[model samples]
Target: MTDPETFIRSTTRMLPVPGVPEIAVYTADEATALWEKTEEQLGQTGLPPPFWAFPWAGGQALARYILAHPQIVQGRTVLDLAAGSGLVAIAAAKAGAAAVWANDIDPFARTAIAVNAAANGVAVGLLPGDIVGTAGTWDVVLAGDISYERDMATRLTGWLESLARDGAEVLVGDPGRSYLARDRLELVASYDVPVPRALEDADSKRSSVWRFRAA
Candidate 1:
């Protein structure tokens, strides 16, 4: 595979998201043209679509909440699981977290996280592979939009529950996806997030930030 960092820098532009103007990210301008440039590099018709190339609604909602309530992460060790675009991790750093780690399995996403964190003037550490079952060492663990899949939500929620049991605060942001088991979570905040028409069917989504309650 080609270097994803180089591909991302060339294909995307740094733009401020519509609602979350405080942070700027390297992302696609339009849905149709998002990954078109990568086609030639892969020499194939379909390459894995880059999730890091856009600011997802769930992540945005979580990030916005964190910024608004800096006390949640201030002076603590924080982790942003499935840290797409490093939005929440950057927000944690900006909110005064002593240290922040952005975890994602995708190499391109990791590079994007590094770039996005730097662009936002925040330094974020990287956890480049899946750390699902591993015990978390941070004070707070944040996940956004990772529960869209059945198996993923099952696996991740189980692990997140464990982290919460160990006394680390676990928070998730989701737009009421099918996989999120709401009964196990406590709603902490809600936002009407504006999403791009191409990404979401609606102009805005009622997204919620949930805290993993005591088991």
Candidate 2:
């Protein structure tokens, strides 16, 4: 496999995140070209797309909300669950979170998060492996753009609800994804987040930050 750091650095460019310009991240200009390059480098077909290469609409909205309402994470331990590119985690750190942990199952995401956190001058702890069922003591738990798949959404909804019941402030950012359990969450904030046409059907998405309610 190609070195993830080297591939990212060579294939992507550091750019300010749209809708959340306070922080910048490595981003790919063209989705199809990057996807093809990634497959070629990894010598695999049908690989998952590089989610870390772009700030999704939901992540942009979440980061914007966290920066605007720093008190939510200020002096608290935070977990950016399934963090893509560590956008939300970096935002939490920038907003004064005592500690920030960015968890993702993807190895490339881990490398991207590390590179992004350093570029933004923030210290974000990168946690690898699956973290969904693990018990956590973080004061706030954040998830962004994770409801795109049905099975994943179902599993995470229950987990997030459990976290909320355990007294963690569980929050999710979504752009009305079909699988999102909206009935189980309370809306905290919403924003018109700019998104790339290559990844989304529209130029912008009406994304919302939601607080998961305890079951």
Measured by lDDT, the strongest candidate is 2
Q: Per-residue lDDT for 1-215 in model 1, tens only?
A: 66888888878899886557899999886756756666666666776567788888889899999999999999999999999789899989999999999999877789999999999999999997889999779999999998888988999999999999999999999988899989889999999888877888878898889999867
Candidate 1 has its poorest 10 consecutive residues by lDDT at 31-40
Candidate 1 — which residues are off by over 4 angstroms? 36-40, 43-48
How do all models score by TM-score? Answer: 0.93, 0.98
Query: How close to the true structure is residue 75 of candidate 1, measured as C-alpha lDDT?
Result: 96
Per-residue CA lDDT of candidate 2, range 86-181, in tens? 999999999999999999998989999999999999999988999888898999999999999999999988888999999999989999999999
Q: Which is the leading candidate under TM-score?
A: 2
Whole-model lDDT values for every prediction: 0.88, 0.94
Q: Give the TM-score of candidate 2.
A: 0.98
Model 2: worst 10 consecutive residues (lDDT sum): 127-136
